[model samples]
Target: MKFNFDQRIERRKTKSIKWSSEVLKNMFGEEDLLPLWVADMDFLSPPPVREAMMQEVEHGIFGYSIRSEGYYQSVAKWMEKRFDWKIQKDWIIFMPGVVSAVYYVLQGLLEPGDGVIIQEPVYYPFKSAILDTRCRVINNQLIEHDGRYEMDFEDLEEKAGDPRTKLLVLCSPHNPVGRVWSRDELNKVAQICTKNNVVILSDEIHHDLVYKPHRHHVLANLKEEYRENIITATAPSKTFNLAGMMSAHVICENSEMREKLRKVLDKNHIGMQTPLSMAAVEAAYREGEEWLEELLDYLQGNVHLIRETVKRDLPKAKFSPPQATYLAWIDFRDYGIDGKVLEEKMVKEGKIALDGGTWFGEGGDGFLRVNFACPRETVKEALERIAGVLNKEELK
Candidate 1:
C-alpha cells in the first residue's frame, strides 16, 4: 500500500496539543505561531490501525479490557522481526506511557535520595521523573566534537561507581541530539553499569525510528548478563503516530526485577488498557510495517531539506542530519545571541515555535530542537521563518 505522507491534514481544533491555539499561546507566548516543536507527527496514522479502531468503535460497548495472547505475540514478533531480538511473551508488561514507566521503575526499585545517572542534553522528562521520585540526578553529560555527540564513558563509569547511584536512565538513539549508539558503545555502557551493580532503565522508545546505515541496539538483547540488569521501555506511539493512544510496554527479562516493577504498578492500579488503545497497538504491530517503511522515506526527505536549507540560507548556524528520530538539534551559537533571546525571537519575530535548547539541561544553550515529522510544505515554511529570524542584522 502506498502511503501519502505528503498530504496535509487539518489538525487545528482536533484537540491536538501540537496544534491547539491556546496551547501555542501558553507555550510560545504567541497564539498564531507555526508549531513544529512537539514530537508527535502531523500525518495521519496507518489505514489498518484506523480500521481496527473503527471496528472497536462499531462494537459500541467500551468496557474494561485485558490483553490477549495475540497482543503479546504481536509485540514479541515485532522485536524479533525488526531487530533480530527474540523476546518471550512473558517478558512484556503494559504501561500507559514511557514516562509513567520511568516513574514506576524509580518508585519500585530505588529509595528517596538515591542517585540516578542521566546523560545531559537528554529528554527533559528524565530529569523531571528523577526529581519527582525524590531521587538525586547525577549528570553524565554527552561530549560534542565537530557537530556530533558522543557519550562520556569515563564520566559514566565514575558516576556509576558511586555507592549512592542505584539507577541509570539511558535514552537510546537519544532525543534532542540524535545519535544511534553502536554495538560497541552499548557493550561498554552495559559493562560499566553491570560492574557497578546499577540498574539500567533503557528507554528504547525511538528504536524503530532510526534511519538506514545506523542501527539501534536493544541493550538487553545484546547479552544475557545485560538482560538481568536492563529494563526496556518501548511503544508504538512514535513509530505509528499513536501517542494519544497512551499505550506502552516495559520489558524486563529478570523475574525478580520484573516482580518489583509489577508490584509498584499493581499498588497503583495501573495495568488496565483501553479497548481502543489495545486495538490500535495490536493492529500497528501486526500490520503497519508497509506504512512505516514509506513514512521513513518521507521523513528522510524532510531531513535532507533541513540540512540543505541550513547550509544555503543560515550559513552561520551548525546542523547535521540526526542519525535517528524526527527531531533536529541545530546550534545557533555563532550568532552570539543568548539561548533565551534566540528562542524569544523565533516565537515573536519569526512566528515559529521550537523547543529551546536550554530545556534539555546543561550543554543545550544556544541551540534549538526542530521537530520535522510534518508535511514537506510545513518544514519549508518553518525553515524560512527560522532563517528570517536568525539572518536579520539587528539580531547579529
Candidate 2:
C-alpha cells in the first residue's frame, strides 16, 4: 500500500501529550510553545494497524485480554526478518513499556546501592530508573569527535569490572546522538560484560527504523553467551507509533533472569493487554512492514531536511545526520551558551519545544534533541524559528 506520509495531520486538540497546550506548559513552562519534543511520531500509524484497532473497537467487548500465540510469533518473525536475528517465541515476555521494565529489572535483580552502568547522554530514563531504585549510576561516557559518537570500551571495561555493578543498560542504535552499533563494537561489549559478569539489558526499541547502509545488531544474536546473559526490551510502540497502547516485548533466553524479571512484573500485576493493543501488535508486525519501509524513506527525507536547514539557517549549530531513530541531535556548543540557557531560548525565543541536551545526563549540555517524525513542514518551521533567534543574536 502506498502511504502519503507528506500529509500533515492536525493533533493540537486531540489531547496528545505531544500536542497538548497544557502538556507543553507543564513540560516547558509555556502553553503555546510549538511542539517537536516527544519521541512519539506525529504521523498516523500504518493503515493496517488502524484498521485492526478499528475492527477490535467495533466488536464492543472490553475486558482483560491476553496476547495470542500469533502475537508472540509475529514478534519473533519480525526479529528474524528485519535483523536476521532468529528468536524463538518462548523467550518473549510482555510488558507495558521499556522504561517501566528498567525499573522492574532494577527492583528484581539488584540490591539498593548496587551499581548499574549506563552510557552517558543516553536515554535519560536509564539514569532515572537507577536512582529511583536506589542504585548508583556508573557512567561509561561515549567518545565524541568531529560530530561522531563511539562507545568508549576502555571506560566501559573499567566501569563494568566494578564488583558492585550488576547490570549494564545498552541502548543499541542509541538514542539522542544516534549510532547504530557495529557488530564488532557489540562483540567487544559482550566480552567486557562477560568478564565482569554484568548482565545486559538491550533496548532495541528502534531496531526497525534504521536508515539504509546501516544495520541494527540484536545483542542477543551475536553469541551464545551474549544471548544467555542479555535481556532485550523491544516494542512495536516506537516502530508503529503505538506508544499509547502501552505494549512492550521483553525477550530473554536466560530462564533464571527471565523468571527474576517476571516475578517483579507479577508482583506489580502487569499481565493484562488490551484487546485493541493485541490486534495492533499482530497487525503491525505481520502487515505493517510495507508501511514501515515507506516511513523509513520519509524519515530519511526528514533527516536531510533538518540537516540542510540547520546548515543554511542555524549557522552556529553542528548537526550530523543520525544513523537510526527519528531524533536528530543538534549541537549548539558552537554558540558558547550554557546548555540550560540555550534550552530556554529554544522555548522563549525560537518558540519551539525541544529536548535539552542536559536531560540526557552528562555531556548533553550545549545540545538539543529534535523529533523529526512529524510532517516536513513542521521541521522547516521549527528550524526557521531557531534561526531567527540565533541570527538576531549573531548580529548583536
Candidate 3:
C-alpha cells in the first residue's frame, strides 16, 4: 500500500507531547506556536504496527505480559537483516527507553564520581544521565569545519585514557548535528575505549534512519574484540515512530557486562512491557520495512525542502543536510544573535518551537535543532517563520 507523506494528520487534540499546549506553553512560553520541536515524528506509525496494536486493544484483555521467543527473534532478525550485525537473542535486554537504559547502565557499572565521556553538541539526556548518576562529564566536543562535524579522536583518546572515565556514551548517527559515523570513526572509538577499559554505551536509536551514500555502522558490529566493551541501545521507537510504546533494547555481547546490567535492571524493576507495545514492536520489525522505505524517501524530500528554504529565505543561516535522522541543526551565528536571545526570538517572534542549540551543551550556541519529520508543507512553513525572525531588521 502506498502511503501519503504529504497528509497532515491532526495532532493537537491527541495527547501528543510534541503538540501539547501545556508543553509548548511551559517550554516556549507560548501555547500557539507552530511546533517543530521534540524528537518524535508527526507521521502515523506503520500500518502493520497500528493494526497489531489495535488487535491487542480489541482483544480487551490487558494483563501482565511475557515477551515470547518470537519477540526476541524479531529483534534479532532485525539487527541481522538491517545492519548485518548477527546478534544473538541472549544479547538483547529490554528497557522502557534508551535514556532509562543509560541510567541503569551507569548505576549498574560505575561508582559515583567516576567520569563519563560524551560528545557535544549532543542529545542532552546523556549529560543529564551522567550528572544524575553522580558522575563527572568529560566533554569530547565534535569539531565542525565548513559545516561538517567530525570527531576529535585525539581528544577522545585523551579523555578515554583517564582512569576516572569508566564509560563513554556515544550517540551513533548523532542527534541534533546528524553525522553518521563512518566505519573508520567507529573503529577508532572502539579502539580508544577498549584500550582504556572504558565501557562504551552506543545509543543507536537513530541507526535505521540514515540516508543513502552514508551508512550507520553498529559499533559492536565493527569487531569481535570490541564486542565485550560495547553496549548498544536500540529501539523501534525512532525507526517505526513507536516512542509511545516504551520499548527499547540494549544489546550487550559480553556475559559479564550483560549480567551487570541485568542486576541494575532487576534492582530497579525495569523489565516490563505492555501487551499492545509487544504486538506493535513485533509487527513493526516483522512487517514494517516497506513503510520505512517509503518514509525515508519522504524524509529525504523534506530535507531537500529545508535546504532550499533555508538557502533562499534565511540567507545568513548555515544548514548542512543531515546524513542521518530527521533533525536539522542549523547555525545562526552569522546573525549576531546570542543563543538565549535567538531562542527567545524563535518563540516570541518566529512563533515556532525548536530545540535550541544551547540545550545540547557546549558548541551548541547560535544554533537550532529543527525536527523535519513532518509534511513538506509544514517544513516550509517552519522555515519561513524562522526566516522572518532572523531576517528582522533589528536583529541584523
Deviation in angstroms for 30 in model 1?
1.7
Error of 2 at 194 (Å): 1.0
Error of 1 at 124 (Å): 0.2
lDDT by residue (8-78, candidate 1, tens digit) is 99998798999999999988888998889989999999999999999999999998888989999999999
Among residues 3 or more apart in sequence or in different chains, the pairs in candidate 3 whose N, CA or C atoms overlap within 3 Å are none
Stretches of candidate 3 exceeding 4 Å from the true structure? 394-396
Query: Tens-digit lDDT track for model 3 on 139-173?
Result: 99999997899999999999999888899999998
What would the TM-scores of all predictions be? Answer: 0.98, 0.98, 0.98
Clashing pairs in 2: none
Residue 180 miss distance in model 1 (angstroms): 0.4
What's the count of clashing pairs in each model shown? 0, 0, 0
Alpha carbon lDDT of residue 227, candidate 1? 82
In model 2, which runs have C-alpha deviations exceeding 4 angstroms?
Answer: none
